[model samples]
Target chain A: MLDLALKSIMRSKTRSFLTTFGIVIGITAIVALGSVSEGLRIQISEALEMAAGLIYVYEESDQPLFLAMASSSLSEEKIQEIEDVGGIKESARFVMDIAYLDGDQQFGQPDLFINGVDPENEELLVTESAELDDGETLEGGDAYSATIGYSLAQDLDIGVGDTIELKEENFVIVGVYKKIGDPGLDNGVLIPIETALDLLDTEEYSGIIVYPEDLDDVEEITDYINENIEGVTALSTEDVAITISSVIDQIQIFTFGIAGISAIVGGLGVLNTMIMSIMERKREIGIMKAVGATNNCILQQILTESVIITFFGGLAGVILGSLGAYSLRFISSALESATVTPSLAIGSLIFAVLLGLLGGFYPAWKASKLDPIEAIRYE
Target chain B: MSKTIIEVKDVKKVYNQGKPNELVVLKDIDMKVNREEMIGVFGPSGSGKSTLLHIIGCLDRPTSGKVYIEGKDVSGLTDDELALIRGQKIGFVFQQFNLIGSLTALENVEMPMRICNVEKRKAIKRAKKLLSSVGLGERINHLPSQLSGGEMQRVSLARALANEPDIILADEPTGNLDSKTGKEIINLMEELNKKGFTFVIITHDPLIAKCASRKLNIKDGKIWR
Candidate 1:
């Protein structure tokens, strides 16, 4: 029976090919859209990982969106109170200075979002593997030491051991860090928090870095700071993660919703193709049933054909979509900065297969229940 | 006394029971066939020969009355049960030959046996024997389109025998053949009948009726004496 069904399909090569193509298109569209959404999620995840150690403390009553846009400073006394919390391995408070560095001289000052950091705690938050084009990391008591991103270094034409004059203060670059894909790491300069404070000429800190002895104590210390610290909001790594995650989630939801439309259109294409195939093969189906093929047998043949076409198209689409996303990431690395991962490929392929199944149902059912006499007579 | 292989008890088939267009195609059709008895039903067009055959073959339901094949009542059987019985106990050869165009002559013959769950090796062996018996041993691998009308009918005959059916239902099996070829097919069927294969053939040709062990003349939806 299976052989007969296969032979029938082979007999109508043009029709079968056309039907398979419909499934292919559906699978491809579904996979491609899913990959885009998955790629966006990974980009956001990496961005959050880059900012893992930096806590963005805000007023407990502050609206999340408002907190995101608001720029506020923490007092030195509040920083000390946060430092006193148990599990706070260290703390540093500093203000941001928007200073541009052109090797050994100042460039037009760019609007840079900078955080004052204690030399000890700065290294903890800065990705340790972060390489620089020039200069060394700031150590407490090292006068005018700084590190810059590879992109920033390239823009300034500076390399390791080069001098960068920021806010009229000349500092020798000890270590130049290779740029991370995240926006925070790619186009910024990291100077000693005290130097940033001196440059801004303020004792107030832009934000504080609170290092926990263990990741589990992050929330506990954050809560303690929230209750005891004044004029400052306390946030842990998790709070920052949740904040960014929620925002990314909203973006992901919106994009995924848009992508879903294309996926559905693709699914409908598959359904339309399968329906036509069923219509064309009505006589063939009757012939099969006449020859003792059960409904289940017919159903299996149709489903197998559908799944096979879907699988092939889905796999191809995933590969193509990943390449597309990767190409986009490669082009934007210099500008926005990020890597597209392979998880998107796997995830989209799965969704494409599911969509294919959804698309295959009605037509397969129609084909299965056709009466032999009527079907055999169908043109 | 030969074994009674099939019995139809006053079966009536009415189309569109509740509609103004209600039509009666078969009215109280009574039929019985003994093993090895070759019967011919002669009728003009619309005499309901095909409807009677379909009811007897369990491919259709009657408006009223019962059909028995091999002594089992088939009227109340579910679709699956009817299908299983058809696959196991009956073979059909239609006026159009109805060979699956995609299958080779051997494969077409092997179809009924395969449907009966015969193993591939055994089905092929039986198909080969049947094809050879029909004098088409050399054309086993030729598809239906490659065969002449006579050859196609011979393959259909082979298929009708593939399941070792108790009876063959041939609906104008020779209608598409030339006169000479038609004679040859009737001779072949007669020879098979003599070998203890029962047959119920529906035909319009009087000459064909002359070849049967019994002749049934049908008119206006009922068998007439």
Candidate 2:
């Protein structure tokens, strides 16, 4: 019977192909969509963890959480005090301000995140946003040297040796920062910390970058800062990681919404194909039953066929979808952008196959329960 | 002197009960067939012959009345139980041959034994022997579509005999064949019957009926012995 069933399935190549096609499409959608979304979430979270200068310091204040939540500034004195904690090597006060790119393009003003730090310790706190194509680094007493992200250079139609006007002052594009594995890095701008602080014209800084002599003592130093310091919230690498994870969680909720829709569409296709296949094989089913096939046998035959289709389709979909997602990552990376991870590839494929199986179930059952005599009698 | 293998007592079949379109097909059908007996049921179209065959073959249940195969009452059995009985005791050969078109003759013949839980190697061996018994040894690898009507019927017969069933129910077995092919099929059946295989054949042809050991004519769901 098993042999016959297998042979029967193999005999109708076209029908089987059509049935498998629906399953394949469904599975592919699940795997590819899942992989790309997971990849995006990972890339974003990783970028947030590696944030160069953004800092959150803890201090003893009347309302610490409120102060952390507030858009108000942290005093330079408080920043300096936090910088004096044990294991702290050097600290730079950073001001969050935007620098509009002077360009030849016809778009609205694209403001880059221009950060401020001390000229002596600028390199300690400020990491390049993109790899330099052809450029020079910042130097003291030189008012024109500034590093710009790769995308910023492209947006402003400026490159190394080109001049970019910052706040009505023309600055030479001395260096292009390296492109990080993030989209946000594409538009960031870096300059001498003192230069930015003077340009923003504020004694109060948005945040302060703290460097610890012993990286392992970062937690203890953060705890000491919270206990002795005033008017700020301390944020360690772990805290940043948690915050990025939560942000990614929110992103996931939205991605899941899209994935959920894709799953439903795929499931519907599976159900539709199973139902149509059942209808087409009604007479054949009845004939089997009339020849002494029990209801279980009939059901098993139909269910097995459904499962087979689902399993094959799911497998194919997974391969194709993963390939697509992987290929997309390659293309993006070749253009020097973030990519989806290969680790999430399997989850999508398995999900696709499961979708096929779940979708095929009810229709297969319906096909199995059909009265054999009536089925045989059906034209 | 042969032992009775099938007994149907006062079986009834009704369609669409309690509805305006309700129709009765079989009313109190009673019959008995001994082991190795070749019994032909002759009837016109819509004469409840197929229904009788269905009940006797255990493919369907009688609305009322007991059907006993090999001395066991099967009317109250579940569909699965009926399938076991059919697989173990009853072989069916349909007018259309009913061989799965996808499978070659050998595979189709091996199907019943496989359903009966026969091991693959043994089932294949048995099927090959039966195919040869039906004079289809050379065409064992041929699909149903590739075989002639007579050859297909032979494969169908081989499939029916796969589990060594106690009774064979052939419903209009040669109705679709040419006269020469139909005669050839009837001869194959007769030879198998002589070897002690019980048969219940439903046919409209008098010549086909004449080949059986006993003849029962049916009209409007009533049987005339």
Candidate 3:
């Protein structure tokens, strides 16, 4: 029966290919888009873990995460109060903002993600800028000396001792940090807090980083600050990661909405093609029935043909979608990066087959119900 | 002492019944076909020869009577049950040759045996033997379009014998062929009948009818001696 169905499909090569093409396009959209979304989420979740053991102390606000993090002001007195708590492993003032360099820069994108660090703090609360690949970390009482991240140095052709103009002030690049696999820290620039306050014209720090000596003290510390500090909110890194991941999930759900529409269109294409194919072969169905084929047998034959088409379409879609994901990384680096997951590809493949069964059911059933006598007589 | 292979008792068939066009194609027809007999049903178009053949072949149920095939009452069977009887006990050849054009001659012959769940290797061997017996051994791999009308009919004949059925019903098997090719099909039917294969050949051609051992005339939905 499978052989007969295959022969029948092969005889009408054009129709079979057009039907399969619909499934392929739909699956490709699902897999490629899903992979890019998944890849960006992974990169972000990994980056979010950079603050794993530290607690962020800031004034409470409902702004979006990145903006809230940069705008949460903590004065010197507030930072001192948070550091005085027990189980504390030294804390430092943290200031962060988006900055733009003056004049021409390599790659033409002069915008830089900046973190204001106070080198005077023996324990740099923000551990991301503690290590340097070239030159030294910012010196105590350093003025206008900046440490840049590895990717920024490469993009802007700046090295240690080179002067970078920020807000009309020339600052010496004292160090370039090593690649830590966190895009925010790997591509960021760190400057002394005093200079950041002077250049950006902001006297107050954005927030204070609080370090608990023990990992188990994180919950107690966060609860203490949120309850006792009145206006300040304390959040663990995990809380931030969950918030960001849910945001990514919303994006993923949006992607699925688009992929689902394409899949529905593909299903309708299969329905149209199968109905036309069955209508053309009504006489052939009659011949099979006249030769002793039961209704179940005829139904199985038609269903198997549709499944065969989708199975091959799914296979081709996987191959093409993986390549498309790879090319998408190069074509549009909108996020951190894109990586195709095996589970997502497999899911798309299964979806393709289910699409076939859904679209082929009614047509197959109708063909099976045809009367053999009248069918044989149908021209 | 021959056993009855097919018995149609007071069978009636009506098209568009109880409506304005209410045509009765087969009216209370009675027939008996014994084993290994070549019963030719001769009739012009619009007669009920084909309808009677359908009732006996288990392709259609009689509206008002009973049909027994090999002593089994098949008229009361469901469509699926009738399909089993058709697969196991009866084979049919149509006027257009009715071959599935996608399959080769050998595959066409193998169709019924496959439908009946005959073992693959054994069915292939039997299909080859049947095709060769019908003088189509060399053309087994050729599709129906590649074969001539007489060759296509011969392929259909091989297919009819594929499942080793108890009866073979040929409905105007030579209707689409020229006289020469038609004669060849008639001669093949005669030779197979002589080898103890029961046949019910329906035709309007007198020359083809002459090959059967007995002939019954049908006109305007009634059978007469």
Candidate 4:
């Protein structure tokens, strides 16, 4: 029966190929887009863990979370109050903003943002994975010194001793950080806090980073700051990671939803193909019935044919989608930080076959229910 | 002293019952076919010969009568049961030489045996022997499209004998062939009948009908034996 089904599909080469192409497109979209989204989520989670020891204290506002993180509601006094919290080991006041840099293009786009870090608290601000690739770290009270991330340095075609213009200020590149696999940190520049204030013309710091003496002290210190500090919100690193995780999950759902729509369209293509096949093979089915083929046998044959179409389509899609994901390096530089290798999971393959089965069911049932005599008489 | 292989009692068939355009295709049909008997049912088109053959072969149910195959009542059998009976006890040859286009001649012949759960080796051996016996040994590997009309009908005949069924129900087996090809098919049936294979052939062709040992003429849904 399966052999016959395969032969029938081969008999109509163009129609079968077109139907399988629909499934290919759908599975490609799902795997490629899903890999990218999953890659972003993984990178974000890793970045969060990398900064796990630090709690961020910022002003509470009605603004969006990202904008709220960028604009400081914290004053110098608020920083003092956060530092005065019990169990706090160290604190850093920094300003961060998206600033256009005048340099060579990375991934055909200008460099992302600049972070203003106090030279005194540079050690606490830079993640542990970061290492100076060239030049030297910023010294206390260094005015206009900038450290560029590894990818940014490569993108801009600049190294130590070179200068990049940020918001009309030419800052000499003092150091370059190694590739840290964090996009936000890898594509941005780090400058002196005083220079950032001088350039952005803002006196208030964007936020304060507080370190706890022990892992157990993190939540305690966050609660204490939230209680003592007025009009400011203190969040443990875990809380921040959870928020980011939820946001990533939402994005994943949206991406998968879009992919699902394409898959459904692909399923409809299967349905159409199966219906046409049944209609064309009406007499053939009648002949089979007359030769003692039970309805179940006919049903199995049709379902098997549908599954074979989708199964091959799914395999092809996985290959294509993996290629698409890998090809991201040639298309975008941002993906270099969070390069996600697409995985062809067994679940997805099963899902594809199930889609074929579902799409082929009604048509197969109709074929099985056909009256043998009438079908035999059908032209 | 041959036992009856097929017994049809007071059979009637109606299409679209309780409707204004009702069609009564078969009425008051009664017949008994003995073992190894080649009974030819002759009629023009729409004379219900095929309908009666279908009822006797358990492919269709008679609306108002009982059908007995090998002394077992099959009137109220389920579709699956009917299919089993057809698979194990009956074989069908249609006017169109309804060979599955995708399968080769050998596969077509082996289909009924396979459905009856015959072992693969045994079924293949039987199919090969049947095809060779029908003078189609060289054509077993050919698809229906590759075979000539006479060759395709020969393949169909070989397929009908695949399970060594008790009865072969052939409806206009040579209807699509020219006179020369039709003669060849009729000769094959007569030879098989001589080998003690029971047959019920429905045809309007007098030449084909003359080959049967017994004749039953059907007209306007009634049979005159």
**Is candidate 3 or 4 superior in lDDT?**
4
Which has the higher DockQ value, candidate number 1 or candidate number 4? 4
Q: Return the DockQ of model 3.
A: 0.66
Q: Over the stretch A76-177, how does candidate 2's per-residue lDDT look in tens digits?
A: 678767777777766766665654544334354335756555556554444434345666556543765676777677767778778766666666777776
Q: Over the stretch A150-215, how does candidate 1's per-residue lDDT look in tens digits?
A: 666766687767777666777776666775654444556677776777777887666656667776
Interface RMSD of each: 2.0, 1.8, 0.9, 1.3
Candidate 3 CAPRI classification by DockQ? medium
Say which prediction, candidate 1 or candidate 2, comes out ahead on lDDT: 2
DockQ of each: 0.44, 0.45, 0.66, 0.54
Q: TM per model? A: 0.84, 0.78, 0.88, 0.89
Q: Report lDDT (Cα) of residue B209, candidate 1.
A: 83
lDDT of 2 by residue, B170-189 (tens): 99999999999999999999
Angstrom error at residue B59, model 1:
1.4
Model 1, residue A268: displacement in angstroms?
A: 1.8
Estimate, for each residue in B1-225, the C-alpha lDDT of model 4 and write its tens digit. Answer: 439998999999999999999999999988999998998888888999888988998889988998998889999998778888888789899888989888899999988887777887898899999999999998899989999999999999999988788999999898899999999999999999999999999887788767778899999999976
Better of 2 and 3 by DockQ: 3
DockQ of 2: 0.45
Candidate 2 — which residues are off by over 4 angstroms?
Answer: A1-30, A44-55, A58-73, A81-91, A96-115, A118-192, A199-202, A210-234, A327-343, B18-22, B44-46, B114-126, B217-223
Candidate 3 ranges beyond 4 A from true positions:
A49-53, A85-92, A101-110, A118-147, A157-165, A168-181, B76-78, B116-124, B219-222
